[model samples]
Target: GVSRIKEFDKGFQEAVKLAFNTVGIQNAKPSNEIANTTPKTVETIKQQEIKQEIPSNTYTSNGVKYQVATTGNNSFLLINQDNNKVVANFYPSSLPNVYHVEVISDKGHYETIGYSKDNSIIIETKTGDKSWVTTTYTK
Candidate 1:
């Protein structure tokens, strides 16, 4: 079984190398520079700009930093210095019996995340709703 797995892995590696050579970046490592080979569509590029604008998320040219707000929801605001616009707005949803609240923004970055009854955490940050990065609750 292990031999079969190794053989499959070897074949996959060869195929990947062939694909890389086909694209002329033969020695590319599967990292950010290599993975970003797919050119961003105009819309996706816009979204990144929007994501950067959201003050609630605290994204900088350096990187997005997650911070727990001290003033609570909505009070935390960030102005996108680059675009001269507001970043995000936080609010509670009317939906009954829900854990997390909603963070809405003009840049189309909306999300809801909260803890579960079973002592687990859930996050939704998709088109309609997306769950992201649930970790073992610490502190």
Candidate 2:
């Protein structure tokens, strides 16, 4: 059965090649012929490295001061200024100027959505069961 299958495959390949030749289709150039063609010169560009300054802004929410800074990897760190502790991490969401905030503490782990507008960041945080509290931090 295997030998018969091999013969059938060989015959099919030949028939396909004949059909291509009948339609005036030519085979691709061999690797050596392609390599012998004239080589094209590629222009090299010297680009200056651009340095961007990351903004570290401080804001206040309910009289508590917080500092927000970029982690340089498309994420923002929310730090409490009183003790310099990272309270939450904000990651960019699909929507523009919107972020998903996550907080982990001895109490529990909480997740919420936040957005930046003007000079303020408004975040809707989960407080108790089925309760969402909105807080706005302004620069």
Best by TM-score: 2
Residue pairs clashing, model 2: none
Rate residue 67 of model 2 by lDDT.
94
lDDT for each residue of candidate 1 in 1-139, tens digit (9 for 90 to 100): 1122357778777777776777774574578877666557755554542211112333342343333332453233334456555443334232222334344466556545543223222334544354354422211
* TM-scores for candidates 1 onward, in order: 0.24, 0.55
Error of 2 at 31 (Å): 27
How well does candidate 1 score on lDDT at residue 81?
52
Where is model 1 more than 4 Å wrong at Cα? Answer: 1-74, 91-111, 114-124, 127-130, 133-139
For each candidate in turn, give its C-alpha RMSD to the true structure in angstroms: 18.2, 9.4
Best by lDDT: 2
Residue pairs of candidate 1 with colliding backbone atoms:
54-87, 123-131, 124-130, 125-130, 126-130
